[model samples]
Target: MSVDMYLGPSKTQGSTTTTVCDNYGNGLNSLQDAVGNFTADQVLRSLAYDSAKGYFKEAYVPLIQGAILVVEATAKAVAKLPSDYVSEVDSCDLKSSELEREIQRYETQIQGMQNQINQVKQLLPVSSERAQHLREANGLISDYTSAKAKLEKQLQKLLAFHAFSTMIFTEVTSLKSAVNQGLAQVSGGKGFNANKGTFSNANLNDRSWMDTIGKKWQDREKERLKDQMPNMDGLEYKQIDFNGGKVWCWVKKGRTTADPEDIEKSFLFNDWVARMLEKYGPDYFKTDREKGVTDLLVEQNLRLFEEVRTGIDSKTGKKLTPAERLARGASLVNSLAALGVGAKQITNVGKGKAGQTPKKPPIVGSGRKVPAIGKPKKTISAPGKKIQSVKGKPSKVKAPVKGTGKIYNANGNPDLRALRRPQFDEVLKNGFPDGTKLNQHAYNSLFKSGRKDIMIDDIIDALNSKPISAKPGSVEYINPKTNTSVFVNPTTKEIVGIWPASFKK
Candidate 1:
């Protein structure tokens, strides 16, 4: 008789269910039943002596011996039965019982042999390496399992959080939509209108009311948005002085019509005048006053005229004014005089005067002695008729001295030559010395007089006591003859002027 232990209340608490005490016993019985079904001869036939037989034999011998002992013990136990058990027993039954013992023994031997075959297979070549690989594979499997578990846990958590967040977002979106709809309804389907009112509203009735309160806010917002947007206001054509001084014209706000006269009037209007005063201050008006106003008006008109003229010409492809013809007569005479072309020569040319005709000299008294009119000539005879033809080489002709062409050589001023080399290297390094004042007209006069040999720098220095006031590159040397100015590049020392330097004499 085998004893079985029952744990208290095997059914889980609070769960109404029956627990099976024989479940583990049934599993063991099933294993035994399968083993018992095999025939002893069949189990023995399955095992053959091979390389695997050594391990099988080792195990099988002891197992067979133990099974034999068990069988004998069982037989002895059965033999103790009363005479009634013998009456029920048959001879075939005894044989079958014995055969079952043999089957069990054979099956034990076969199982041992199978274990030995597995062992032998493990002992094959590189078995240790294979074992190690299997172990590593097991370790990787463990790692993957752990990682999968962690990932699954994280995924679960994320799914939960997503559900929660989605719920919250849905709620918030619904709330916002509802609130917005409510606001729209309250504000007459236009949303919350902060500054909405009728044109005739009491607040808007006074123009100064908005000017007083909303101006600053509107200005700030405008500035903020202006910063955000690119200013694509087109090419703002501002009327500027030729020298880029004060602005002559500007597009007036709310003025769509571009009439030249109207534009001028806009510039001269009170608002513009007030703005100008504010920008330039009272002194600008006081000092300039009439001249400033006149200049502003003139420039405005000129700029408007130029704009209109350019637009018209572009459209028509024609000039509005005729070619300005040069007047002859006194104007020509005056121009020649201005050019320093002698007035008398021009007068003569104007009158068509011709040079006087050449006259023949008077003949002396015919074959008679006549007194010489002026000093008597002393006649010298040709050097005593040498009569000798010298047959030597001819004398060499001496070369004539070249003319120095009107250059003034200072009498005893050797220091003047030193001036050619730079003096006060730092002070006059850029140009002439400081405090130099140029005779404004000299540059044109010198060039006109054909004094080409005079260096421009020297002429500038000569005219000024100190340095030239002009920046190095700013010195515009104008040749009156050509009516063109030479623009000297300071860095490259490049002189760019009109073509044909001769024309610029």
Candidate 2:
């Protein structure tokens, strides 16, 4: 409505009793131009509130903040910064009231200083007008000094701001370069040149022996071995820490021999063991000893299983006919032997593996009365208090008296039937592998020699004293400690002599 709308009379110039309504409305556009406006920079500079100095003395703060925002926007185009702190920085502002308050504070300081100077001047005698002018001049100089100090403070702030911006630019530039270089290194067809590893590189995820040492080192080791062993064109070397020492493993690439046939055989190095070396590569077994032992057991069993399946004697190099092969594939061999066909009886039908002697199955027993397998175990009484103790030593067990430990039943008769091969049972009783002796068997027998420890008369007396009824075939005592097998005939009461265990059964 116009100015006439609210105070305009409903009737033209009509005189009426007092009827009043307040009209205080101002048009919406009346103050549009009068509204205050502020720029981003001015608002930033109005932060200080000095009683006398009023407002930001320098404009560098707003400039510094503006530069920071520009750099941040630039950085966002390249990569993520540590943090985008610019938005928080932009939120800070200065207004007139704060600046006015700061000016008032400084003004109060000036007033206080002036009063002090006036009190000193009053304490002195009265002076001429010219002298008074000189005193007033001193006051002006003091004011100028304070103002100069304040101006220098503002300049110092500008310098600090410049330094801050410089630092930010430097940091952002470094970040961008690092990110770009990293991306180009892997994605630019040049894969990272990280070490496959050294033994001491601790960053490895899998801490197995292989991973501890880098892949490059292993490959170099392989090449080195190949160069050293001309015969093993594909020689490989693996390292293992065993028995608190480092052991280097050597293996052939294929089933070929590295040395001439006439050379002394190194049983520890061979193709059969190489498979184990490969499986445990980089990933180490507990120690060198474990590796060697496991390799021995594996190769021995592998050969045994292979021979049984194919009916080919690995040692003799002889092949079996269809009938003999069928006999093995069938359970006929075990059944026949179970019925007392001699297990040691060489069945020519199964003659196999050429270029070697035809070997028989392990002689489980050597008597008509002995069954195929599984002989009873024996136990002996501990040394009793009745036996006098040896001087200077605790009561101890002497070597076993032969025939003393025979197992007996409630009937009081010793177990004299179903005999086991004593010599082998002693050496490999824990597990008598099916066919061949282990490679370590020779190593085991290195300390023992063959000889008759007990003569026939002594053996006979020893057995008769115990009242152990003898079996018809040879009676043997296998001593794993001595690594020897002593043989005798319990029924015949004769000594057959002692033999050292061999690598091959």
Candidate 3:
């Protein structure tokens, strides 16, 4: 049996009911099929696999080599230098010197280009040849500017890496000494404890002990080289600092990829990646946030992340202003009491477990009792009815409808016509016909809304719930059970359109 998942009214505030994912596991798999087409997911998959292999080889490999060189130098200094001068040979200090020299070189080149442009501009006649020279000089200047910008960014990362490496200088020196000793033993020299292990003078070149020592060294290197590698996390919503702004990203939760395919496989299982990409940019999937694409997307779009995390005022069903969020407890209580309920907790009720299937949140209109956690139960007790309690006592009576979204006629009674639609009834009883087709309009709506992950079967399942008529020969079937809706042609039995709870504005 599929695990039952409940969703609140965050996505469908005006709807009569909340959502429930009855087939949680299967429905999530279908959503995965939907997210495969997202550009952000595609970008992450590429970076963590073969497609970005060439880029890593050309760009990251050199950074790794440079960092290793600095590491080796620091280790040598720590081992051989006197305590007083050891600080002078620090890796970060050495990198800063190199970065200064590189910056000076770029500045000199840019100055020369500017001189040529100035000479061209000062010419008495503006000839076509002179204009061409001016254009070339300007182009050269632009290239230098871009190259210098990239170099500074890369060097900054290297500096941070070198600084971090200094914390482990003692360990690196010890490992290096061990490696040197192992080499000496392999060459029949007096090094390592030959008498303590199986490596006697006769079996000098035996590599069994060396292999074990090498494995330990390799593990340390992996930890040291994390900055230069593409490390992907599992499926989860993790808040990370990206491009000077905080954003919630799926690709960077607190974990590491076990295999190359693990990164891509993780992407196949969630919509947070799609939401982040749609909110920020394609760089949302970049493994190295420190060395990622430098842009204003994150800074510009962080409000959405904040809203998703903690913004909605539960009592009013409106976004809480910054001032309102930070108000003194008394003022906050008073304001909320003025709006409606004073005791309601104003927190994100829909933040589910890590990598859990995220259903559309309920748009909680005023006066509805917000659940203390997650969402209300999958079933809504019929209005005005009392069920026998688990203890076998009659439950308290429920009040009649207020201004909530439950379907009601003009005279304020439950609309039975909406409660019973024959087309939906037949589909729930016998399933859809073989020739039933999803039309172009529905596909367009889903694609534009980042909900192309909603499958046709999901729509059919949603039809099992109550429906309200929209027009002649058409009915709006909403199923909170499946978190999907279908506008159906009762006579033709074709799916005219769909509205999925996954849709985000």
Candidate 4:
């Protein structure tokens, strides 16, 4: 059996022996016709058919391919007509989307920056607090160091006092022992009376008695040395209160209290010696010859003083060669004497003149007037006017009058004949003169019209048609409507009244 075939939107049944009729030709013709009426759907469907045929390797593929070819050719023709029209529409949509993304990104970035700034701002007070704490800690350390230094100085003073007290006690003990030994040697050879009456005779020179008296003196000295010993019995060496505390020590033949002043004097002397050794050398205190010590220094000082006096004397010397030392001494004495004398004279004068006031000088030439310094002389211009002068005063003169000696109206307008006609004509032709008046009518008209295009000639012609009778320098013009005098520029034709046309009169 035979059958017909159809494709696309129209379908037909066909015989088994004959394959589907190649309707792709009609499809291509339809595509070609549709190309003239190419809608987007037709183009998509044609492209799909070409893609299907290329995939299937069918014999009728040429028909589908031809459709693609026709569509592509038509598309190329459409493309040639300004691609920007399509691209511009697409680009505008793309730009809008891109702008939205950019704005969002910008806002996000701004928010992030603001967050970071806020975080940094929050840390400022904390950082400032830490810095203040650090400063306070540093100040505390400084105070501690100062207190430590002061304590060290106090400890050194205490150590010095302890050493001094110990030394004084040792010296007193040694003196007491020496006194005891001397008494024992004298007492070994003889025996003497132990009576207190033996001390009453000043000339009694018995050796035994002297030995007895010396033994007793030595005993008393030993007791005094013992009493003067430092009161270190119950205290540790470091804890001993040597400063301002009384120390009992044994001295020659008796117990006594050691003088705090004497002990302090010893310490002060020692300190002075030590300081002298440190500063000047150890040999500084070996001699008592002050004259020898001061001689060179005195000579040096004298030489220096002499040099200074010589310079002063040389600068101040008048006639004779100045004796440096003598001149300075004489000057000092004279200055002192002058001060005394001048003070006394001033006190004695006491609001009274020391000398008589000088009399006024007599006037010469009947006290005739002469001009004072820098004073301009006054002049009188009138022929019969007399120049007057008072005694001892300058003669007066009059000032010359300014101008052509002719008075004009207060407005500075000249007479009609005085106006320069040639200058006036030039000004009239060239618009307003350098200084000219404007009339009310022309002023109002020109300003209201705002007509800058009108040339100087136009103004001059307008005014020349009717010569206005007005004073020279007076602004005059013909009224545009009335053809009468209107106080515009007679010389130059510019509107010459008040400015700002809105202002009247």
Find the candidate with the highest TM-score and give its number.
3
lDDT of 4 at 458: 35
Model 3 gets an lDDT of 0.38
- The full ranking of all candidates by lDDT, starting with the best, is 3, 4, 2, 1
Winner by lDDT between candidate 3 and candidate 1: 3
For candidate 4, write residues 1-505 as lDDT tens digits.
Answer: 1111111111111121012122333455575454334332334455444433332221122223333333322222222211221221111111222223333443443344344334334443456543543343334334333433433333333234324423323322433344344335334322222452111222223334334434544564564443232332222111011223211111222323334443333333223322332332212323222323222222222322333333333334533222222222222222112212211111111111011111211000111121121221342222443231111222222111112312254577543222222222333343341233444454334433333223232333234334445666655444332233435544554455422222332
Q: Residue 479's C-alpha lDDT in candidate 1?
A: 35
Compare the candidates by lDDT and give the number of the best one. Answer: 3
lDDT of 1 by residue, 1-505 (tens): 1111111111121011101212322443454454444322243432222312332222222223222222222222222221111222211112222223333443443344344334433543456644543443334334333433433333343233323322322322433333333333223323222453211122222233223223433553464443231221321222222211112223434443334543344323323223332332222232222333333322223322332324323335554321100011112222222223222322111111111111211111111111111111232122342111112212221111112212234673333223322221211233322122223233333333343333333322122211122455544444332333444444443332212245555
Q: Which ranges of candidate 4 are over 4 A from the true structure?
A: 1-126, 186-505
Model 3 residue runs over 4 Å out of place are: 1-105, 118-132, 164-441, 444-467, 477-495, 498-505
Q: Which of candidates 1 and 4 reaches a greater TM-score? A: 4
**Lowest-sum lDDT 10-residue window in model 1:** 349-358
The whole-model C-alpha lDDT of candidate 4 against the native structure comes to 0.30
The global C-alpha lDDT for each of the candidates, from Candidate 1 onward, is 0.28, 0.29, 0.38, 0.30
Q: Tell me how many clashing residue pairs each candidate has.
A: 5, 25, 8, 43
lDDT of 2 by residue, 241-355 (tens): 2223222223344433233321112222222223232332211222223333333323324543354444586777898543223222222222122222222331222101011
RMSD to the hidden true structure, all candidates? 59.0, 45.4, 31.7, 65.7
